[model samples]
Target: MDISKLKEMPYDELRVLYKQHLHSLNISKATINTASVDTFYLWRKDSKTLFWDTVLSNDFESEARSRLLKTLSEHSSGNVNALVSGYLSHLRKFRLYISSDSTWEQSETNQVKTEKNTNLRRTKKDIVIPSPTVEQVEFYLTKWDGLENYHLQEDALNKLFLELCPNNTDILDILLKASTLNDFYSTNIFSIYPVAKHIRSLNIDTRLDAGDVTLVRDIQHVTISNKKRSFYSFATKYCSHHNPLDYPIYDSYVDEVLRYFRNRDNFSDFQNDELKDYVRFKDILIDFRGFYGLGTYNLKQIDQYVWQLGKDYFPKNYGKKKRGDK
Candidate 1:
């Protein structure tokens, strides 16, 4: 297949082209598995140049290459020379196209330009909060109440903190679980223990104010390395449980739900950077509540609504079952 022609073709057309090529090569259906086809489809969707590059590389670890080799070997009926010659012929043509054409470079340049334009638009966009209906608010409130009660007992550290003061051990335990649970990236949980201890020492009255900038600042001060996300997750849950009406949890789910609602309602886009700043995030939540006349609902209730909403509408973002319950 011509690399330029493949690049010009739509994803659906590209898949058909690939399938037809496989058939022409006399590759058996048994060897050309769905996984191989799906992988190729994904690659084609991502970048035709990349897909061709990998296919031509003949890397054993590359799924496309492995599947192609398997198919060729099977068709050759144990004739090693025929299999080698057939594989080389296909590989040589693909290699020649990639080496000769500037398709890959051009594609990369276009991708860069597209990303630049997207960032430019994003910078100018203002986030808009959606207005919730009375019925929606009531449903969220009920779910929030139920979730709060359930998770309070489910999370060991949360339950302990509710009964006892914010001690180092309890605080560290919360940090540990928050860092490890459903975390794709591994965090050094023990490294952040000092940070948790400092937070406990500050005795930052969790009951003071929900949107306390000082509280976030204090927490940030103790953040040694890349533990900000883990620390904040633990802090927000602790604070929210202490004063549900004041503090709301901030996590990936909440962020996803907020964006989902905004997009669903065609509201303005909020920056992920803004959410990183705890103060800005809290202000956004407060403004969001006020905008929708959701003052009657507590912050924890709002958190519950966002979480449940994400789980229902954006299951891919939630990952594991019953994860955000706590």
Candidate 2:
């Protein structure tokens, strides 16, 4: 943390400390490894092609800056400026580590490294994830209100359900439509009828209980091709579409967003696994609202806020990821 001490530390020790610093900042193991701070002694090399061109120069432009600034700001020292200066100095040392055959070349490397680190330091000092505020939430809500495509689709689906699935008397058709529109592909085609029947049996209209959500999720044990499948996320979405006020939807985006904030803010005390439980997930969302002074928003508003925030900040690798992946 004391960037000033980086120069004095041994090469191996610097690698360890840098890796630990990244872990403390909650950077993924994959990212830390790819940075190769430990694997290749990235800090000891003074080439732009090393960590800079490959990792820091390409991905997570805003995220890296924000996280670094936020971590330093929250340090016990509470002197963001001094800490960032130390960090700049450390990066300078990194760029100055070139081994050249000639003194002139080494001098050129030192000059370039000094210039790059000076710019890097200035940029790092300005990096920040603007603190959450009521105005910012309202801005996002307004943005949500102006949306056209997704909202139109959602509105149409809600309308169809209003006309067809008012009370779940016979909702197999409506359920199928909902699944298609919502991309609930995890549920088997044949299993939809049984899930609908199960929901009809519960008669979960106008109100929803925690047990109701759990029962809906657990009751479906249909096996197709000897593969047992339970539509837990789909079940939550189904119940939420029915009663948005009582049931908050659960999906990977929501899950990641919750975990990110929980790690950063300590808003609530719950395990990551607890998010799978509808009761606890809803409670955690409530706690998030309270912690951020977002009491004016309802559960649905909070859901929209966090869902959009997740999509923006923690996007999925869409080419390799699917719904329900954590």
Candidate 3:
């Protein structure tokens, strides 16, 4: 979209545009909603805080600036791929409303919003359980009980999903509905399928739970190219006894965004130090949410933004150099 048009559009208008665009691309409302929330946060983060602005400030003693300029200078004359990669790095890191680094002022500002009377953007609701079928619910519980992490890792994962997923009940109800629907594969069992596959692969004596099939399908569904590695390639080892499919996986987007926002060469570097600063990370999330006026968000949505940004920016550098090409 034209930068002016994008900036000019209101939140409601932006939502409509997102839905239309994603619809055209055959992306589901669930997926689009996830992406839309991400875009909203990105814009919000870029607009509100100096986290990003500080990086490109061009002042000496500005560590981010020195690193960024050094990077660009090195790649500018030598490699289109590297230069474009650097540019993409900055965009993902210092995204719409947040900064690469945190600040005391940013923390104060978000704290103020949470100061008791801060009007809620969306109603925070409790977990709403829909009555599917008595037999089905019992069976699901039984299956869940049989699972290794039924009360532990699996529970942790579910808590994360519930806290983050905006249309939480809908997805939950879908899981419950599918189990007894008996269509199995036809029930868009894609998401849960991978979890089941992973579980069975581990030689873990586990039965498929309510959302298991859909989870699995989601893992390898879009991954049409088996020859190409997954973004969650690191999980191969940690995921031995555990089901990697059960986890909501992120691609390079998460890494790219962190790299951009941190002005770091990579996410691994930032994690080493900044991970200690919980307040800083919370500020990052809050600034991002308000910048986009997105309803609710979690880390996965952040991943999607980075992924989208990568896909958005990479092609320009793929074939030729802008300054030296063709």
RMSD of each: 18.8, 13.0, 20.8
Provide the TM-score for each candidate, comma-separated. 0.46, 0.55, 0.23
Q: What is the lDDT of candidate 2?
A: 0.54
Q: Give the TM-score of candidate 2.
A: 0.55
Which regions of candidate 1 deviate over 4 angstroms?
A: 1-131, 144-159, 166-192, 206-211, 220-230, 264-269, 317-326
- The best candidate in terms of lDDT: 2
Span of ten consecutive residues with least summed lDDT in model 1: 122-131
lDDT (C-alpha, whole model) for all candidates? 0.51, 0.54, 0.34
lDDT for model 1, please: 0.51
2 or 3, which is superior by lDDT?
A: 2
Position 226, candidate 3: lDDT: 50
Error of model 1, residue 56, in angstroms: 53
- Model 3 C-alpha lDDT per residue in residues 162-210, reported as the tens digit of each score: 4332121244533332232213112223344333343334332232222
By lDDT, is 1 or 2 better? Answer: 2
Query: For residues 14-69, what per-residue lDDT tens digits would candidate 1 score against the true structure?
Result: 55644543343333342233222444432533566655556555562355545445
Clashing pairs in 2: none
